[model samples]
Target chain A: MSGVWGHSGNIEPMFQSATAEAVEERLQRPRGWNRRNSLPYTLVFLIVAYLGVFILFPIAQQFLTSFSNNVVGVDKVTWVGLRNYERLFEDDDFWFAVQVTFTYMVFVVAGAVSLGLVAALLLNRKFRGRNLARSAIAVPWAFPEISAVLVFLWMCNPTFGVLNIFARLFPGIDANLNWLSDPNLAMPLVIALSIWKAFPFTFLVILAALQAIPREIYEAAEVDGANPLQALRHITIPEITPTLLLMAVLMSIFSFKQFTLIWLTTGGGPYGGITETLVLRIYQTAFRFFDLAYGATLGVSGFVIVLGLTLLFVYAQQRQDRARRR
Target chain B: MNRPGNGLLLPRSLSMGRRDFLKRTAAAGFAAALATPALAQNAKIKIPLVSWMWNEPGRGDAWRAILAKFHAEQSDVFIEEAGAPFNEFTNNMLIQSQSGKINGALFHTTPDLVVRLLRGGHLEPLQDIVDKLGIGDKLSAAHDHLRIDGKVHGLDIVTVKFGLLYNSAMFEKAGLGAPASVEEWVETSTALTKSPDQFGIYSPHLMSEPGDFWFILQQWAVMFDGVWAEGRKPQVNTAPVIEGLKLFKTMYDKAMPKGTDTATANQMYANGRIGQQLIVSAAVNIWSSSGPDIYPSLRSVVPPGPSGKAITRIHPICVNAHASDDEKAAAKLFVEWLYKPENYQELMERCLDVVPPYPEAIRQEYLDKQFWAEGYLAGKSITPLEIMGDYIFFNQEFGNVVMDKFSEVLVANRPVEDAMADAQQELEKASERLFEGFTL
Candidate 1:
């Protein structure tokens, strides 16, 4: 009986020793040369290659194009290094568009994240028809952008738009306001539409993060005589802070690149470029004016801005990782 | 292999060794490979004739019918319709030109786009076709811009001249006749307007539709005998141009649908809610179909201002220079056939077009039948080249600067003089970089 038990234990050690030897052999080999390690490296190479072709290549081309005199119908295309950049520096419209982009980004990010957080907190509570509420909140995220723009155009129509009815309900308002055409209201209305379209995505992400929190933490806080608000302030918020930071970075990116909603709504005008962002400016320069070199210069500037956003995202992810470890 | 539902069963006699099977397959494939190009050569060369008119309502059907006729009469070539909507077509073509080749073997270009394409050398000179057709001496003055180095690169297919197209029923109901001067025009328009229910006039003022706005905006200055530029020098700050902008503002405030888009404005015009539109002659065909009730009552007149001149823009059909030699030859053949006196007359009639590309393109009898033809013909024809001057190549860019500043005049009630002054400065600065390395 003793011999039988010893033989079984020896078989387990033998299996362990064989696996350890294989691992040690792998470690002894030079990095990235082992046959087994090639799978991950190959996968990584594929991802990097894909990004290089589709993303980095275009960016490199645009950077090169920025230094050329490449306007359509020009007699010849030649390098005019720094001339485009000098023009960009002096361009009033480009600066105005930059200012508009930042304004739009700040408003949309703050509006989306705060609204999403509030909605997520409310929906986090157990209640009747909670599933229906959760599904209902995601509808805007599912709606197509072009379809939304068309519906928004109809709703803002001065003559027959349903928005006019609501405006008329106000005390001082007697006539239908020119909603999109009024320069004062155009930016605000465009921002509102963007928020409506964008908030649902943030809401979903925040809700997922909220659900991931353990119920025991809350139960423990309640046992310590902490009220709902205190528990929310100490437990809920601290847990979700990383997610909120991540969402802010993502929403900033989203609003930074928003084009179709604002374009189809106001076309960067009721007068002037009251709502024009850098993307629209880039399009107007390249496509409308056929000033490809200047457009490319604007594109390079936009790339720098996107690079900054990527760094912000990386920092946020690192912070989230640190928090998770704690 | 003979099992049910497994695969097709080959007869034992038809079965072959692997090497024999491979050889037979290779021989059959070789024969197909050899025969493919021969078969293709015998088939009609299908060439796409790209034009925004293919997407237009009545114009689309008219062009398709003309294509069918051309197909019926031909054996060596077939023409197919290809194009985007009007708003996108010019930009699409421009992008194609930038890429060193246009998409189709043939394409129609707007008045401005034709100049750009000609300068880019994307158009094969159609002088031979015009000369072969014997219409060279009779081409309209609007075709002047299509000429380069004494060779015509394109042939005019449609000439849309601006005019005051109005719903006569609305004017009749309001007891008004067409105004002969600017003051009367404003008074008549204001009197006809009943806000929210009716608008007396509409000229695209919204920045959202810059193409239509700028295109028609050029004509407003023309109404006052003003040219936007003269030999690459902007004349936006001139008195006539200012007056023209002021007139537009007055009409916008008191008469026009303040913020209406072109589509909605057209709908309003069709319903008799809009009295007048300072639009092109080609638009009449659209109204004839969309607004059948008002179509019979529609009449056009010389726009009311000091100048009776209207901008006559010729859209030309050109063969793509970059197309294969075979495709180019086939496309030119279609162009020649389409430009034949009889075919051209039939096309003009079907399109409800009054303007003839030449003296003989439209029969006098047919011209006499079009009641809407008088105002368009009576108005002096001012080609875009004459107005835009050397800036003809940079028309949209020049127009954008003017439009942007003038938009303030309409929306924020900025003084026209101040706005035009700013536009003049902007245009002067832009001209430094705009005409570099290019000759008129």
Candidate 2:
């Protein structure tokens, strides 16, 4: 070929430059787009519109109503400017509701996350009928809340409930135990039910995180003379720490807003507002008493507190990320 | 086709006449279309009537039948029964009234709730309707319970008398007679109770359900001649009130099922485990229908309180303030028909235990029923229409306050005196808040 066209090699540079010019000319021209290009923009607009109509508008209206006086059997609303908040602070029932809510949140979050972690660890290992066991564990979460609550109410009945019958079999335990009506036992029972309902989500999330860790790392640790405990501590724990933090935040939010199970079971209780949380208080204030303004104030206060905790969680996550990067 | 310049076209004068005829026809057709709806409306009047009685299975069906009859008789007027369960209907009505959009032309509620609604201007003054229908002469003296400041705002469709209801089988099994006084009630309850298997008495004692709890406590107070309020001010810490509360606590501890609500307790009663209940007469109708096996064993008598007084209520109904004038007229006509002797007898017969205040409606044959013996009928003479004076005007919120504190004593073992004192304070605060500008 070189002998056939000795001058072809000398023209190669010119050929390459001409091809480069053709590509540059194409790149310089504007792109022609069809309707397909607008898909992402349309999706974003739809999402924003849905959030605005369903979520943001109601929240903003609630916030505004919190500052006004909307009494029962009256239509006129007068701007009172934090008077409802002032009154809420002075109200004894409000404080009791706060105490109940915080206590419930702490117990539920700790119990759910700890139990979920234990469940995740068990499910991650190979066992006989392992899939069946995992499915069985999710049964409570899948059961409808109201239906489960009714079953629980029956089980906790003093006379005919199965729980009392079981408790009686143990020595020194009273057969006529009023499980739901007893002030001392009501909150604990509520917390248990909430954990039973919520822990499955945490379990599933943690299990996914656990399975994603490289098995080779554990095998390598084993070859280097590290035991199972040491490997779990140094590798597994650190890798899944972010998932645990996020689950805790999620469970806290869910427990704080719990209404149906608690409302249906004891209706905040056998008396003395023993099990009434902030959300139950808000419902009672708005629907039962028809004091929408005060209820809105309570809702707003709960929202602010939850927001602050979420921000704290975010800060902790950022610090962990920075430490890992370093 | 004919052109304007064609010789075959119509003359200008003849074309103008034809255009005028077409215009008149079009105008007439438009006017007829517009007037058709008005003509149909004038022919028939439909009034929406919402009833809390819809929650009562037997009574709801009975009332529907009566409304159907009225619809048949008055061909021009119709009653549309908007059905909702009692609790939901009450809440929805209150909300609708407050929102200035009452859904129905007429509503049936308890006397106390009616008073509060009247004060809130949710009910129209029925004085005109009452006078026009001659209802004042036809109605029993119990109708006075519906008046506020000399204006009749409601009419009583039915009245309930509260009394001691005992299972005759249980009484026979325990070898105890009916309780004739508060002490006897305690003794009878204690004698009949055997934990887990059977219990002595049943009452709705959950403070969270304040309305029912307050009604029960009001009955207790009335029996002891104890007053919780004098006009607008609260008198919760008085000796009689405290004594009555102490009695309640003792009954809860010793005889009644602890922490059991009325529904649970009624289940116990229906199963023949409960000895007695201080229930309204109408409850017998429900118990009989649900548990027919226990019907023969049930007997009722006026609750023998220490004061020789009893608590009863006149179930009153009112026209909604938001009702149109035509709707109001139809509603008044319906009420008038309901109070007529022949129609009233039919209503009384349909609702087994509920007694119409009208003498002609109270038949001797109904009194002979196992559940409605002479003992239960005796209360019609002395049962008081008004309860605890201005307690009716205290609204449901005041009851909530009292019940909240009332719960502490029953659940937490707080002293009756302390709980009553706390209740007094809370009631005063509530009264100051709820009844600010009006006289109780």
Candidate 3:
């Protein structure tokens, strides 16, 4: 029957196209939309207005005020043309800040993702107390940022901290490190804390992607005489590739905006601790210094930097996808 | 003890509007109120303070203590103080303002960006009320920071300042007396830094504007020979200033710790590696209170620069221009009461690190135990007015740039003079732009 009168197939492209056209027409029909159904549009309008007034407007106000020529201590603002930007350019601290923040973002994002992937792979397999362990792993994420930081701080306290106690007990660690005070150690410690706090998020996402992998593919690989280590190499990585790409893009943004842990734990100590990220600097500039113009300029640069990195990631993925599709 | 008691008092009658509860009076006549009036009055004043809950005495304790006392003074009106955390104070204040739950707020200093509140017309002006109460002159005569635009808006019940604290042992070792002139100070600094164990000076060369940079720079600029205009515009290129920078550079090159930088000072100091710190006199108590290992053998002195005239920065308690009328009135009373010698003493005792904001408030305890009194008194003035003959306005924004730029130019190997000139230009622009036309 020539596959039920199909053009070399049972499925008819014409019918599918015709049905899609009918639905499109029905959707676009002016009279078909119930005039009484105004709730959806009203909801949309309200959401936009709410965001504009509360969130968007404040952001715009900050951008505008950053350009202000108002005197310090007096709240009166006037637009100053690029003076803030010019000042920021010459400011030595600004350049150093740029270097510190960019470095933190690079290291944290790369390090966290790498470690997260490894942790995800470990947890992906079945083991005794795997369920309990999976739940236990998320405990760090459950603690509030400040509370977790407080505990971490107590652990890191130079004089009588638990970590120091351990160091002393072991007699292996030479001298107790002042985790909060030493500039050399502070940023890396913050990065460590951030990674600890953040990896759980990546783990959850990766686990989901790992679980969604078809069991049969692995069975097929095994049937083809693929070894456990070899099958895992080919089967696991390709399956969760999309999720890994999306997470890299998303977490890169998160690391760029990672301020609170640093703000609370260190408050950008050690005279602008190795800890002040772009977000911290922007916050201090905009809120503390009240240099909205310079703040905006820094913010814009931060935005460009973050967006460029994210786009590069996305573009790379898109190109890879296209190459595979081709 | 850190947790507050769960308690509330009802006035004698609920038959009236909630707003009218202020009129309800206790049965005790004025004479009867005198004996145990505090307890009864505390049971009555319906005012409550929203504050932060912390272990060490933060700014909230000062406010809480004042409110607790106010409750005793006004038996008919009770003041209840509740606290959250400092991190959430602003957000909580915003929410409270929205719900109109705030009777008044307790703050150490007026918030910087109060324009939003002023725009909302949340603050009540105290001019007319001050005139009626006849407390205006009494308050400002003691605390000048209360006036905004010649009108009263905020008040400081307590204040503090950074005073140069030195290691007298180091001074003795160097066989150098405190320098009264720029030349003497530079020479002293150069000699003191011959080794790693000691430093001639240890001050933040860079800081956020409106920070300690102004204090450090004030000590330097005046002695080194720099000046600013009526607008607080700094003239850094002057010969004295150049001489000062040259000395500072020489100190940087020959004397000061080779590895000194913004990011390393705390560690360096904690390691018992620095000799001088221009700490707030308040830190004298903290230093004494701290564990001996972390604490350095400390003494206090002002920068004996070339001018021999010592100048430092002040953390003045200013009034928020947006406080409501009743708030303004209550706040005025608060400020006045705080300045009363007894109340001032109580405040200093509670704040621990802080001394009374005014020189008039200084007493035997401050003189004997207080670092500023023990150390930095160079022809003491009773109030800040005495210091004003040698004053430079602290610009928070400009100070921020100075600190930032200073560290960059020096630690990061940028040219010192170029960094200074660039810093001044940036800060001046910031001062111009951030503070366009303040008549003050």
Which candidate ranks first by lDDT, i.e. highest?
1
Cα lDDT of model 1 by residue, B39-103, tens digit:
97679898899999878888888998888899899789988889999889988888788778899
Alpha-carbon shift of residue B335 in model 1 (angstroms): 1.3
In model 3, what is the error at residue A136, expressed in angstroms?
10
| Residue B22, candidate 2: C-alpha displacement in angstroms | 22
Q: In DockQ terms, which candidate is top?
A: 1
Residue A258, candidate 3: alpha-carbon lDDT: 83
Per-residue C-alpha lDDT of model 2 across residues B1-440, encoded as one tens digit per residue: 43474566876655556679899889999999999999887888887778878668888888988888887887878777774787686677666766666787888877656765776677877777667756556656666756677667887777776777889898998899888878888898898989867988877776445557777777676667776677667877888778788888888888887766566777889999898777777777788688777778988777666665556677777888767888888887787778676887788778775566656656666655545444456653332334444545544556666777777787778998998888787777766665544453
Per-prediction DockQ, in order? 0.42, 0.25, 0.10
lDDT of each: 0.87, 0.77, 0.58
Writing each residue's lDDT as its tens digit, candidate 2 over A1-326 gives 12323333353442366687656754554554424446788999999999999999989989998998776554356798988999889989899999999999999999999999999999999989999988988898899997898778778877677887789999999647877777889899999999999998888899999999999999999999999889889999899999999999999899999999888777787677889899998988877666788989999989998999899999999999999999
lDDT score, candidate 3, position A185: 78
Q: Candidates 2 and 3: which is better by TM-score?
A: 2
Model 2 clashes, total count:
0
DockQ (model 1, Cα): 0.42
